[model samples]
Target: MLNSSFDTASPSSMSNMSGRWDFGGEKEPLMHRIHAYPAKFPAFITQKAVAHARERGVEVKRIADVFCGCGTTALEAKRLNTDFWGCDINPVATLIARVKRNDYQKTRLEHYLADILRSYARRHRLHYSPYLKDDRLNYWFDEGTILELSRVKAAIDTVPEGKYHDFFLCAFSNILKPTSKWLTKSIKPQVDPDKKPVDVLPAFEGQVALMIKALNEVSEQPGKPTKKAASIIVTGNILEMDFAEPMVDLIVTSPPYVTSYEYADLHQLSSLWLGYTDDYRKLRTGTMGSLYHDSDFNRDIKNLNATGYGIVFQLYDVDRRKAKATARYFADLLKTVRQCVKLLNPGGMLLFVIGNTEYKGVKIDNADYLLSCLVDEGFCEIESTKRAISSKILTPYRDARGKFTTDTTSRKVYAEEFVVTGRC
Candidate 1:
């Protein structure tokens, strides 16, 4: 029988067991500030959980994040000198994570930046072929801004192969939105016509400096003089990847929310600029909840044993396509959960940082459904805590039609999220 002692209490009732889990606090660790990811969980959450496990005499030798977005868990694991493994469908995310965990010489990066600046300064009016074209290019950037960005790209291309090159490329990627017309405050990619584009060179230089500082801070942490832990980051679909039985000691991840931010569309600026793909929409198909219509899937939704099926069935009469899409999302997530269960060692802990949100006027209790899935997969509930999200990067408001919105007065979507833990 499933353990039933855990309480589903409100955020206000939860104790500050691990102090405050703050992402934007003044004392926030610089390691997680490497890149801005949509709805990324704070590193403090992972650290607190690991500390608790250690106190209970748990041997956390190998850690894995099935949907490791930008490698927050992996980085923390590395700091603690534990082997880490992570995978994601987003190539850009994998690239960022790999670079974040890599130990690069500060002097090498300084020299590379100097070379790029000198090369860039020599080109008084260098004209290079634009990497992107048509509406994709014009929609987010003006001609002048695109030209300046192209120059920076050309300079980045001159860096020698290996981690040094990837480091500069990541820096360039971080500055893409700020130097373009994309809305700065919005998670979804929306062009702000009135937004002024910043100068590419200075912005990129500043980002490089910040990244170097963060890297140095991480390396200077007081600990054993042991060698750095090995980390394996892969670009692959989570549902299809395999981890042999009893491979991982712990799993920490935040899976993508249903009908939330379209990750492929959100990262288009970096995708096109970095030449990861010519069509960003093509990358959308494999992602969860990418199918918006009934024709997109061949499977029958009625076959899945999901607690949220009743809500989806109700949605069918209102919007058949969205209903099928929601069903597909759950089906995909279940497959992923089962895969994760198979990989984890006996008694290993799986901690998911998830939030419940509404879809097409139907309340999708994502956290509850995930808990049910875990129980069905043979995991016992340990403890779950609901905490208020003080500062969130994802847009919390949805329009009347159940679409994400930037409307200031729109209803709040996920002001709180549950950090649920289960033992296999």
Candidate 2:
């Protein structure tokens, strides 16, 4: 129930942000906070989007989130009794998204915990040969910490493959950063020489305790929506997904910021430990705005709309590398919009919770770019609105770690974001 703090944007505001997108559920569910996710929008946005669709006479029987970062929309869809289909390139995201949606049996959770504890105590098979060879793991984790996490992983595997196994694996995956040298509360990946790694068993148990509380809260909490529909979360690049037929009644999602965060780097600990990839850098492939992709900028620049080209053209003079990435991002969004149209039933709605970012004094107006995309794709009834991200520019600056600060020397993050919607 995270608050949107919705209020009507002033009539003269250039963005013309409608106040309707501002109203939503006021508190966040405990289930949604089980894992840390970069750029996950407030869960209530899903509720608000659903309500918006219903108000427009769209009966949302099925919903989809093309870029379902950490499954915020998926869980809310289940609570609202609408079937959900979601996909993310990062497996770490899909794992948490899948786990967050299930209402597991308390007894089974306890049973698995007790078994894992006993197996962990025995401490056999602690030394995994791969640990010695993996440079990335060695850089982050000490030898002792690796052995302890290995035992926890092995014990978690003792649970047969299913939601229960995934649940434990998700727990194990979260503990990797705390038990390693990775800096705390920092979005950037760096080793904190001062960080004394927390003991594995205590951290794992604490996480489990927190998860149990979340489960209890979901089951006993009054006003918690009943689960009436199932959620399907997939791990794959959305750009390559083939939609053979229109399947969803509505699409509600927030697209990733162009080159703002490298999801693969952010989730390296989980991806590596969970065996998602041998080299975490490889996960960058096909990721939106990733500089690593092979993009022919000269040829692809034609796909951009005026808003898109203007932003890229501005950046090209100062930074050629970033300009290429930005152009590719624009092209991808254009294609993504067309693909989204393919997934929607005729007259279905596409609602996006997106924001704009600035780089080197140049504005990257993502909202406007997307609005143009919706138009190019021929989505009718297009609408756009603005919402506040924080106290209006009270702490407009972000420190090196991506935390908000009032200091003018730091990077500026706009206090406002846009909510753009259209009907296909």
Candidate 3:
């Protein structure tokens, strides 16, 4: 399923002096477009790392992505036959990952698709009150559009519990940002006035059909060997997870960018529509990120108000220029990393996919700083890779002024991300 054999890097290519492997190109074979997020790495990057592990005579049974946004890592893992475990603070994202990774019967998926469509057609005309309504709905969509989405979601909820249920729930989540008035200003949702709102029923139907096609294409491929284990994806905070020591093989993830996209606020429509929360703005403050972080943390807005610093330093002292936020965030990150390190088999690898962020012109070399934490905590920096985000095939979102209106920088290039590997 992976095209790694044709593109594997030679030993000479692995040198740090080469700077970073250019994982550039428009032809990302993995499922990057399954759904759109403001910032997500191509699945091929993960493919490269996994291939590197195999080349080292290492047998990888399990792969875990803590910030499994939109399931990029999990999807690639399934394609490569690696036992996959994923976790995310967003419930909707975890739902998407589960639906994509599950080995559902192909015939069953087709049957389920047809059955749900027919069921939806029968119920489409029924009148019903909106699931969760607020002023935002009035500001975002007309009455007809809301009614259409409500009926479709209600019908989807009624699908018999099985593979179909998971698929439809994810489909519903995917449809939220696109069909509503949430503008393509960026990954985050902003109510758009100039653009016409899309009709809900047709949009829902199109998504279902698109999903079936994607599922069919992916399931047709033969898979590689895996750990024969099912990865668990939790929809709650990782801080609350009860994991025993040494519980994972490898840790790979890209946490939320500093002072960049406001994830919860961006997906407020989904949160509101799916019964996660009725108060939309509350998402901005409740999450431990961005300027919205609690005052108790003393987040530095001039530093792009990044949260989660102190929790990280507890694992290792950070040598960054500024240390404004409480050590709570860094401490929590170390706790999670320590849990991941404990989960690994001896000599297991940790591949961290992170970015150095800039907020109000302050550099937050988070990736490098994070690697330092790992190194200080009994991990060895084996190798690292850096790549420009500009080289990848992007969906190309921008405003008339040729600026990224939604991103915090409002510049052509926003932040730089990296893939740093450490061995324990």
Candidate 4:
């Protein structure tokens, strides 16, 4: 059961919010970059949002990230010594988050690292018979490279129950994209038609080395994140979580950008290695549908009331470079907001780190739409800040003429993250 003290009703009188403030900051290194993710909001964005919640006298004893990609929100929460929990449909991502937030004994980590290395030295020279008949594999890597990756997977699968199992699994997950033919430019698994990719074997070994170094640096830090009191990563869809009533204190999350990138296909290599999905086409169902679909806004409307979670959207599909139909978009967005409200502990605050998207040459005012959802749902607006999208690492494209493009027609997104809060 959730604590009752934090579940009080909202203050009767509240102010209607109209504008935004500047909240630009730097990104966190080490973990967020363990592997590339196309549009992960910076750690600084989450940190500042979390800090803003603290200033309002909101007793954020526990934080929940519904779409806990790469574990940014949970990790920052752990660093601050706050109890944290999160869920995601992607198993590989959940695995990485679980490993990053694991409470490992320093001595045990050293022992586990040494054992994996020793095992690799003995069996690293062996070869593996390819299990999946993915022709794309040959296009991206040579025989030697694939065999080595097989060996790495074999070592982890064969390990006995120990503290390093999750750690080892994380090390394996980190190498998925880096060792593939995909460009490091986007977190998606994009095959560059212009260039022949590197062999997987050498890339696999290199990523393993980098993983070890990152773990070493983390181990050396003064105070590391131990495990959370309660941790969970649901493979089931977030829309289908089996819960009744508001059960969380704080909600921190960044849902997939409106029809921008396919999280599943981008990480397909990991899915293949981990034995999750064999068909790449299957990944689309888990992602926000793209603009090219024949149904367009109609498809979203079908999913709106079905989701049961409140997520407001004023987004332009950058792929087609146009704003989505507002009725269908807001309906789904309202459902997401409603889910957030139902999941909250009465007056619990919800934090959204969303950005504006340009669609069909028009900006979809997502922040304003979110505020409207709060008002309709019987929630009170707390505060908000808009930050210039300054972090260039996540932005990685230039038009044919070498100019920065803002329209969504060519799949371009300019940085403009917004922070919004409201009591449920």
On lDDT, the leading prediction is 2
How would you encode candidate 3's per-residue C-alpha lDDT over 1-424 as one tens digit per residue? 1123212443223324343444543365434465556567677777777766667655787888878878888888877777777888776677777877776676776677677777778876666566435687767767777778777777777778766787877777777776777776555556677767677767777777777777777766665354544767777666566766555566667776544566787777777777777876666553434445544433332222123343233322443322333233344455556666766777777777766544333444565456545655677535656665655344223343433555544323333456767677
Candidate 4, residues 275-296: lDDT per residue as tens digits?
7777655655634433232345
Runs with alpha carbons beyond 4 Å of true place in candidate 4: 1-29, 118-128, 161-163, 193-229, 289-330, 393-412
lDDT of each: 0.76, 0.83, 0.62, 0.60
Ten-residue stretch with the least lDDT total in model 4: 9-18
CA RMSD per model (angstroms): 3.6, 4.3, 7.1, 6.6
Q: Any runs in candidate 1 off by more than 4 Å, and if so which? A: 7-26, 55-57, 132-134, 291-300, 392-396, 400-412
Kindly list the per-residue Cα lDDT of model 1 for residues 266-336, writing each as its tens digit.
88988888988888887786787665423333464654565757656776876777677777887877887
Give the Å shift of residue 130 in candidate 1: 3.3
Best-fitting candidate, measured by TM-score?
A: 2
Over the full model, what C-alpha lDDT does candidate 3 score relative to the true structure?
0.62
Q: Per-residue lDDT tens digits of candidate 2, residues 234-299?
A: 999999999899999999998888777788999999999889999999999989877677889987
Superposed on all Cα atoms, model 1 deviates from the true structure by an RMSD in Å of 3.6
- Per-model TM values vs. the true structure: 0.89, 0.91, 0.80, 0.77
Task: Report lDDT (Cα) of residue 214, candidate 2.
Answer: 84
Where in model 2 is the C-alpha error above 4 Å?
A: 1-14, 17-19, 124-129, 221-227, 391-411
